[model samples]
Target chain A: MKLLKLIFKNSLRHKLRSSLTIIGIAIAIIAFGLLRTVVTVWNSGVDAASANRLITRQAVSFIFPLPASYRAKIASVPGVKEIGAANWFGGVYKDKSNFFAHMAVDDNYFVVYPEFIVPKDEMEEYKKNRNACIIGSQTAKQYNIKLGDQVVLEGDIYPGRWEFNVKGIYTPRDQNTDATQMLFHYEYLNETMLQQSPGRANSVGWYIVQIEDPNNSASVSKQIDALFMNSTAETKTETEKAFTQGFISASGAIITSMNFMSFAIIGIIMLVLANTMIMAARERTREYAVFKTLGFSAKHLTGLILGESLLISFLGGGVGLFLLYPLIEGFERAMPKGFFPYFYVEPITIILAVTATLLVGVLSSVFPIHRALNTKIVDGFRHVG
Target chain B: MADIIQVNNLSKSYWRNSLEIPVLSELSLNVNEGEFLALMGPSGSGKTTLLNIIAGIDRPTNGSVSVSGTDISKLNESALAKWRSSNVGFVFQFYNLIPVLTAFENVELPLLLTKLNKSERKKHVETALNIVGLGDRIYHYPKQLSGGQEQRVAIARAIVTDPLLLVADEPTGDLDKNSADEILTLMERLNKEFNKTIVMVTHDPHAASRASSLLHLDKGVLSTNGQSH
Candidate 1:
């Protein structure tokens, strides 16, 4: 206990150096947490996907559409229960500044994926009205989309502006399923696009499939793709998770680079801590010698130095985590729509940061402790001051 | 006189790559309990080496050193350190008190190695500080005190554990004449009143004069000065 007290006191010998080292550790940990959260949020779509669901999109490009009649064939496939067709309808609200993920989904969207729950009365009203729309709770809050408000969407592909009455607001049943999308009637886009290309009006961006048995999803997906092998829009069927993962796969190299960069950040933290610990240890050479001359063993001296390093680094890590939570939360609230859905430091990230700080503490103390222990008693005496 | 520290065939050497330089060659000595002895020699006479060996801070190349019937030479590095913490207290020439510690904290350092409780350790430190007449200055840091007061605190620290052997290596080397005299008087009183077994190394004849006995060394061999009170 006394040894610990001495170690604590000695660590505070150079307040500026100690504080700076801690701040450095804190900054490193905060950066590590943010990077890990970025990776997590990036993969969140895949992580939160339901196992029983499958998506069939254009084989070569999602920009191409599948014939809308294929949805009826998919719904009749053995073990298949329900199906809905939806298209990515890129739109801006008010102006380009207010952007969000706007999709034209079928009225059967509720039956295709039951995870997206809407109030019974709202769903009935939405089904009764052709121009009714559904917005995610988060999106509704962001744009103040009340149940009666008319939302005007500026379209990029349909060649005409569209308007819909907000009929319902939905919240996610799970964390991975983001409640930030704007879903409306697929007939509205089909009708508008038919005016431009009358033959393509009977097409959709993708088919969402729900099966009776989740374990047979892979077999069913293979069967579905085989059925479309000779069709004009050759379909690629995949689990919802794989489909979401495909979206992120486009930026795989960038995410990999970020992973490498985070490791580099840890390495830099180690170096800075090592430098500070070495400096502190060197400055206390005479003091350590005195300790040795007073009959302190090599192990005792080692403990003293390492204890100081661990204490400083751990304290810094704690401070870094403290700053991270509020900063990320504030940014989460102010985040532009569809940029980062869920930004947070997970439990795993916290554990990783703490473990990294401990490793840095031990590594940083190694050289200084070695230098201190190797000093001869007589040499220590000679340098007395 | 019963010998408290016994050395036999003691020798120490330094190696510079291929060359072996002997500091002390096949020398031996014995000191009885409660004896105040001064070791004096010219530069390079190996007085400091001899003191270091007896204090267990350095190992003899070839020899055995037994203090209070324990063969310190047979103990490993860690065991020897533990033994020395309980057996020896050192007062260095420059008043080598740790600058960051207060007088009381300095005195409490060696006591940390003991199993004594905190209150008991405090009592021992207070008694030791009072012995050096610096009890009131226990809270003063080493830098705040004068040279004499600092040395007195060093003395207090050395004797705080009441070690059987108190080793002084030129304890008054850095002081003025009056301060040196005061330190010498304090040493005399410690010898007469506390009956501490003191072995001091000094080049100052005036300091040596206060010792009950003096041993002179030249060329690493001890020769009795035959001067005693």
Candidate 2:
């Protein structure tokens, strides 16, 4: 107990240096936490993807479209239980900067994605009218859009000024479910495109196929892709997770760099802590020599040094995490809505943050412990530091 | 009385880029229990080095030092540390108290190696502090105490474990004359009343005068100016 008191006192002996080091460690941990959260959010769609769902898109690229006729053919596959189609209606709502995912979906779309829980009456109302649409709760809250409100969008890809009536607002079934998109009927879009541009009529960006058994997804994907083999819009079918992952992997370098940077923060924290521990050990060389003469064993000396280091690290980590929760909340609020949908710290991020600090604590103490333990009694006394 | 310390043919040296710099030559000494012996020498006379060897804080290049019939020089690092903890205590010139600890905590340091509980350790610490005339100042940090008071706290720390011998290297080297006199008087009482075996190294003849016997060293060897009172 007395020894522990000494360790605590020794760590705070230089208040300014210790405080600065702790602050440095804390800031580094915060940076690490934020970056890891971002990486988690980037891959969140893939993690939330349904295992029983398969996506069939143009093999050449997602930008290319597949015939809407492919849907009936895909639904006939033995394992296919249901099928839905969506066309990416890239459009500007109010302003280009006020961005959100907008898609035109077939009537059976909600049946495949059960995580989007829309009111049955609202969904029926949306399906009854040709110009009715459903916006997610996040989008409704972001834009103040309500039922029976009018939503006007200038289409960039389809190239037209379009308008629709908001018929319903869909909320997420769970936290991981995306509530940042707007969904409308593909029939309205197809009827317009059929007259405006015959080449783009009755086509969809992707087809979502629901299978009877999730385990058969590989075979089901192969069979769907084989049906469209050597055709103009060759289909590449895969599990919903892989399809979502394919989009995430398009920014693979950025996520990879972010992953690298998060660990780099851990490395920076280690360096800061190691520097502090080393300086503290150096300053106490004579004191350690006195301890040696007082008959302190190597174990005792090690305890003193390591105890002080770990105490400092744990303190920093605690403060960092304490500040992180509110900081993440404010960060999410400050970000443009739907910019990073579901931007919350994952449990794995917290675990890694804690484990990183612990590792830094032990690693930072290594050189200092070795130095203190190896110093001869006479030499330690002679050390000016 | 039994000889509490035995030093036989002790030597110490170090190397400076392969050039051996000898600090002490083969020397022999012995002191009985309860004897207060002062080692006085000029600068570079190796009095401190000799004191360090007898205290078992430093190893001799050759020969052995035995305390209570145990050859301390033969012990390994940890064994030597264990032997020193129970057998030897050291008082430094600078009072080397851990500045972060209170006077009471500083004195309790050596006894931490013992199996004494907190209250037992506290009791022992208070007694040692009272013996050094600092009982009322146990809660004071080294920075809050006078130079003489700090040295007293150091003496308390040294004796707290009740070691077999108390070795001091220039104990009054950093004190004013009045503080030095008080320290010498306390040592006198500890030797006369407590029957402690003490070996002190100093350059001051005045400090050496308080010892029952005196020896002078020159060039790492004891000179013939040694005498007993």
Candidate 3:
């Protein structure tokens, strides 16, 4: 305990240097935490996917639509319970920068996804009107939309200005599930498309199938795909989680880059910490010699050096984590609805940051402590400083 | 009196780029218990080397150094360090007190190795500092103290563990004339009143005069024929 006190005091010998090093370490930790959070948020889509749900889309590409007739065939598959379909509207509000997810979903979409909670009256109101729609709570908040407001969507794909009444605002039952999407009846889009372009009618972007047993998802998915074998629009059926994972893998390079960036920040912090420790050890050569002359063992001196290094690292890590908590809260609040809605720093991420900081502290001190202990007492005494 | 330090044909050498530079030859000496022995020599005459060898801080290239009946020359580096901690004290020329620590804390350093608790360590440190007339300045840092006061704090630190021998390498070399005299006087008092065996290396004649006997080293040869004043 006495040795620890001495080590603490010694670390403060060069006040400016220690403070600067700690600040540098804290900044690196902040960068590391932010990057890890980005990777976590990106993978959250897959993490929050329901086990009992399967998504069927065009085998060629998601951009190509599947004939809505495939929905009945998917529901007839042995393990399937219920089915719903949606079509991507690709609409922008006011400008492209004010973009949010807009989709045309089947009237029975809530039956397949029971987690999107809407008030009973609002759900009834939505079913009563053809041009009525439900927006996520996050989307509603973003545009200051209320239960009786009119929302105008300038369609990018259907290429028409569509107007709808905001009938309700839905929230997610699970916090990890996104609540930033705008959902409307697919029949309205189908009828409008039939009048504007006849060929695009009776088509959907994907089919969501809720299965009776999650364990039979694989076989059921295979059975559903076989129904559309060699058709004009072949279908690919997979669990909802796998579908989300497929989207993640489609942008594999970006996620991989984020992972690399997280590790790179740790490396940079290690270098900075190592440099600081080495310089401190170099300046205390004579002091170490004094300790040796007073009968301090080489091991004791090494412990002192390591203790000082660990102290600096732990302090920096704590401060960095403290700063990160509020930053993550602010970031989540500022993010657009439906875009990375569940972005948060997980407990595992905090554990990893602490572990990395400790490893950096121990590893960085090894070389300097070894060098300090190896200096002969006689020679160390000769060093005036 | 029984001998506290017995040196038999001690030698020390350094290698500079594969060229051997001999610091001390096979010089032999003995210091009795409760005696003040001063080593006087010119620069590069190996006075400090011999002093270090006697204090068990350095191993001799040849010959054995027995302090308090233990052959320190044959001991391993770790064992020598332990032996030095409990049996020897060091006072360097520039005081060598940790600048960040108070005088009391500096004196308490050697006692940290012992199993004594904090209060016990504080008691021992206070007694040692009071003996050196720095009890009132226990909380003062090294930079806050004058040269003489710093050297007194160093003395307190050296004796806090109550070692068998106190080894000083020019303890007053960095002090002014009055401060040097005061440090020499303190050493004299420690030797006479506390019966502490002391081995000091210095070039100052006045510093050497305070010892019971004087030994001169010239080119690694020791001549104990110089009479003490």
Candidate 4:
């Protein structure tokens, strides 16, 4: 215990160097945490997908639409329990400065995905009113829109201002729900489209089909795709998770690059920590010799040095985690809903970071501590500093 | 008095690349129990090397170093270290008190090797500090103390563990006359009162005069320099 106290005091001999090393470690930990969170955020969409549901969209791209008449044909499939259609409304709130996802979805969407918890009475109101809309929890908070309030959105793709009455606020059951989306009656959008361009209103963007047996999702997906293989809008049907995973795969290079950058940060941390430990060891050569002369064994001296290194890593990681916690919370609040439904530091990331920091501490100290232990007591005594 | 330290034809050589330089050649000496012995030699006469070997801080190139009847030369480096901790107290020229520790803590260092609890260690440290006349300055760090005070604290640390031998190399080499006198007086008092066996290496005649016996080293040969005073 006395030796431990001495080791601790010795570490403070060079305050500036110790503090700078700790700060360097903290920066690396924070950067690594942020990168891991970004990767997790990208995968969050797939995690939110429902196992029992499948989505059918244009085979080559999601930009193309299929004939609305295809919905009846898909509903008739044996494994499919229900079907609902939703289209990207491509609208913004007020002006271009305000940005949020606006989707035109049918009343059956609320039933097709029951994971979205909606107030029972509000569901009936949404189905009855043609101009009513359902907003995600975050979107409602952002616009301060209540159930009875009215909101107006400007359309870029369809043109002109669109008005709707807020009918309900939907909360996500888990990480998969998009909280930044604004879902309104598709009939309202189709009626306007029919008045302007009758041909466009006759088509739908995508179909969401829930299955009776979750295990048959893949077979049903194949059946749905075969049904439209010869049609004008060739379809691709897959489980909801596979569709979301496909979207995430589009940014494959970006994720790979971020992972490589994290490794680079770890390397930098090791170099910086090793350098700091070297300087510390150099400064204490004579003191170590004194300890040696006073009866401190080589292992005792090494423990003193390694103890300092471990303390530095433990402290830096703690402070970095403290800073990261609030930043992740604030980010979850500020980011558009549904985008990063769960932007958080998972237990695995925390555990890995802590383990990595400890490894860094041990690795950084090994060279210096070995050199110190190998130094002859006489030579150490002769050292001026 | 019986011999406490025996050096048998000890030799030490330093290596510089392919060259070998002899520092001490076939040196032999003996120190008795409860003796105050001073070692004197010219600048390159290997007085420090001889002291280091006797303290088991360094090994001889040839021959054996028997301290308190144990062959320290035959012990492994780690075993020698443990033996040195229990058997030797080292006082360096510049009063090498750990700069960051307080005077009391410096004295407490050797006691860390002992099986004593904290209270017992503290008691031993306080007693050691009191013996050196620095009981009031126990909490002061090396930088806060004067040259004489620092040496006194070093003396306290050296005697804290009550080792079999106390080896001081130029204990007053860096101090002025008054401080050096105070240091010498403290060493003399420790020798006389505590019955400690002290071997001090010094070039200072005034410092050497305080010892009960003196050995002068010239070109690695030892001869007795009588203590008349």
Candidate 5:
């Protein structure tokens, strides 16, 4: 313990150098943590997907819609318990920059997703009104929306101005669930399309099937896909998790690059720490000689060097993590509501950061410790520094 | 008087580009217990090398150095270090104190190698510092102390472990004339009062005059006849 105290004092001998090195290490760790969090947030959708739910979309592309009649056939599948349908309603709220996810979902959409919590009275009002819409709590708070307000959506795909009455505000029960989506009655859109453009009616972007047992989701998905084989709009059915993962895989290279960047940051930290420790050891050549002359063993001197390195790295990592929490909270507050709703550093991420710092500490000191111990006592005494 | 240090034909050399450069060659010496012996030599006379070998900080290339009856030249590096911790104390010309440590901590350094607990180590460090008349300056760092005070702290550090022999290399070479005389007086007291066997290497005639006996080395050879001044 006294040796550790001496090591600590020696590390602080050059106060500015040690402080700058520690700050550099802390910055690297923060960068690493941010990169990992980006990857985690990107995959959060897939992580939150319900295991018992399956999504059936057009086999060719999600942009292509399937016939709405597939919902009834999908509901007849043996293990399927409930079914819901939704169409991609590409709309602009007030300006192009004010973007939020707006989907046309069937009345049973809320039934299939019980994780979206809504007040009983508001849900009843939504069921009674054909033009009623339900907005997520986060979106509602952003636009300062309330019940009975008219929300006008300028359609981009259907090429018309659609208006609806806001009837409910829903909050997600799960942390990973996106809480910035707006869902409305699909019948309203279908009926309007039937009156204005008959060819676009009776089409849905996807069908959500809730299964009786989560374990049978894979077989049920296969059965549903087989039923739609060779149809006008062939359906591809998969677990919701797989469906979400497919969306994320569209940017697989970006995710891979992010993972690489995280590791690269740690490597950079190791080099910086190694350089600092080497410089310190070199400067203390004479001091090490003094210790040797005072009867300190080579093992004791090596331990002192390694202990100093480890202490610096651990302190830097701790400071980095301490600074990261508030930075992440600020980032969460600054980002668009739905863009990264779950931007949080997980406990596992903290563990990884600490482990990486410790490894960097140990590995960085190895060469310096060897150099210190290999110094001959006679030569050390002659060293001016 | 029983000899505390016995050197038999000790040799030390360095290898530079496959050529052996002899620093100390076939040197023999002995010092009685409680005696203050000074080694005076010109540059390249191997005075420091002989001191290092005698203190167990360096190994002899060919012969043996027995201090307090242990053949230190035959001991391995690790064993030599352990033996030195309990048996030898070293003082250097520039004080060689760790700049970051206070005087008390510096003196406490050698005691850390022993089985002494914290309080025991503190007690020994205080006693050594008080003996050197730097008890009030125990909390001062090396930079905060003057040359004489730093050297006194170094001396306190040397004796804190209560080693059998004290080896000094040019102990007053960097001090002013008055500080050098003060350090010499302190060394004289440590020898006469505490019965420490002193082997000091120096080029200063005044420093050599303070020793009970003096020997001179030239061209890696020690003169047989020593003189007392």
Candidate 6:
């Protein structure tokens, strides 16, 4: 039999031990993979953010409003290509449980986010009616919404029942695109505010600014914020990536714990596999002595020990990865819609997982290899049994 | 017969907390080609230590051992290992067969070092096992075999490479009388018919009587009074 065959047979020598170690490693890998996927989904927005797009929000916080008149000032900025006024509507559809991002946006908002694919006819229908709204494909699917259908919202922030027609449905341009937001006319909300809370009228939450060149975004953002410097509504401007990153920080602890736990799982994997290997090596001391007597080199013993470790590691890792895809799918389905807009197993996660498993395999074999190579044949024979 | 194995002023010692504990001291010895020589001694007599030195599995603190022509004591660890694979066969006291490997696989271990094809190695393994009267039990694991059968499989492994010398340390020490006689008879036939040289260390006089020549070790040195050739 080949040396590989011997390695394979030796790994199976203690059937229960090998199997248990393999299962433990597999489960740890799955947990690590799941945590990694959560972390990836957590940053999906930042990954999809456009470099040329920038957000100008009140320096105090995103919750505060900017005067609607600032949209014209932002549009006049030297490098600004397109600018739109928008506000966080926070309008609940039916009950508080039916949660989704509802935002009020002017016509140019859609232009700034071209990744939202809206049809020509639907765009015309949406522009024709001030009460018309565009819901993302996922949002449409969740509410079973259709074009020309009236969608009513109980305004939690504005304290009024509002009605709007679904004039268009927009789909995501790519996997990282979030298709879970509902966009309606900012003017419609502004008009209701003017008639009701006059003080909150003619104000937008933020300005969505697109620039001529992404390289000029930093200068343009500085120029936009400088326009309102020392004013009651001082603005903080940054690229969409930074905006999304700031948004992710809202749930920072969860992601931080997941990052910690992912690495913690790797440590655990190394310890479990090392324990199994050390025990096996101890039990096979005399056998290694016999091998030396038969003229097997230290390199051969290393191959046997390292090969068995890698075999078990890869077996566990392979099974864990195979189980991860379905587990993530189930996890995604079990969560409320739009909870994590783009849940995907990124390629880097697989690369890191495979790399970690191989590293752990090599690491676990260190002590065993040293023991095998250092033990004199005579002393090993003395330790028989 | 030419002296196929030679030893000159060999010494082996272990260091315990800066104290010297000698196992073999200034020992000199020789064995002719095709000779089945047995070494008999009491516990702590250093017979096994001497056997290990001759087998290239351990090193001496002083002096040299030459088998056939090469001074094995002068070879580096890796080179000595390679030389042993090509020139020396070993049978251990406990019949140290790999418990995970089948008899066929165990016999194939030494041959794995050779540049032989799978079929060629298989043929050599079968021939060796047949010579040891274990041809039909090639697929059995070491744990599946009785004490005598395991020793036979280890012997099969030892001879499969057709090495120049065989060194067995208490090869039949763990076997019953009938099994011990069978193993000794097999070793004798290998020496007499095939001319395979052997140096065995044993405690039992019955086992030593089966050897064509005999020696005794006392106080870490060879005893000339019990020496016979």
Quality of model 6 by C-alpha lDDT: 0.91
- Docking quality of model 4: it rates as medium
**DockQ (CA atoms), all models:** 0.61, 0.72, 0.79, 0.72, 0.77, 0.82
lDDT of 1 by residue, A1-385 (tens): 7788788877788889888888988999888888887877888888888888899999998889999989877887898988888988887788776767889999888787666778999988888888888988877887778998999987777656788899988887876667778888998778877887797798999988988899999899989998889878899999999999889998999888888877788899999989988888777777786687678889889889899989998998899889989877776767665577556677887888888889999999999988888878887777633
Cα lDDT tens digits for candidate 5, A123-196: 99999999999998888887899999999999989889999999999999987777878899999999999999
The sequence of per-residue lDDT tens digits that candidate 1 reaches over residues B23-83 is 9888889999999999999999999999999999889999899999998888888888888
Error of 3 at A236 (Å): 2.6
Clashing pairs in 4: A48-A176, A178-A338, A179-A338, A180-A337
Whole-model Cα lDDT of every candidate shown, in order: 0.86, 0.90, 0.89, 0.86, 0.89, 0.91
Clashes of each: 0, 0, 0, 4, 0, 0
Give the alpha carbon lDDT tens digit for every residue of B1-229 in model 4: 8999999999999999989989888888889998999999899888999999999888899989998889999999889889988888889988888888999999998998889999999999999999989999999999999999999999989999998899999999999999999999998888889888999999999999999989988777787763211
The interface RMSD values of the models, given in order, are 1.4, 1.0, 0.8, 1.0, 0.9, 0.8
Which residue pairs in model 6 clash with each other? none
Q: Who is ahead in TM-score, 1 or 4?
A: 1
Off by over 4 Å in 2: A119-132, A144-154, A158-169, A191-200, A212-218, B223-229
lDDT of 4 by residue, A1-385 (tens): 6677887787778888878888888888888888888886787778778898899999878988888889999999999999999998887786664567788998888888787788999988888898888888877886688988998887877788888898888988775467767888889889989999897897778999999999998789889999988878889999999988888897989998998887688778988988988888887888888889988998888888899888887788787777888877787667654455445787777887788789888999998898899889889888875
On TM-score, the leading prediction is: 6
TM-scores of the candidates are 0.93, 0.93, 0.92, 0.91, 0.92, 0.95
Q: Considering summed lDDT, which 10 consecutive residues are worst modelled in model 2 chain A?
A: A335-344
- Against the hidden true structure, what lDDT does model 1 obtain? 0.86
Model 4, position A361: C-alpha lDDT score: 88
Better of 2 and 4 by TM-score: 2
**Chain A TM-score from candidate 5:** 0.92
DockQ-derived CAPRI band for the predicted complex in model 5: medium
The list of candidate 5 runs beyond 4 A from truth reads A119-122, A144-150, A159-161, A212-219, B115-117, B226-229
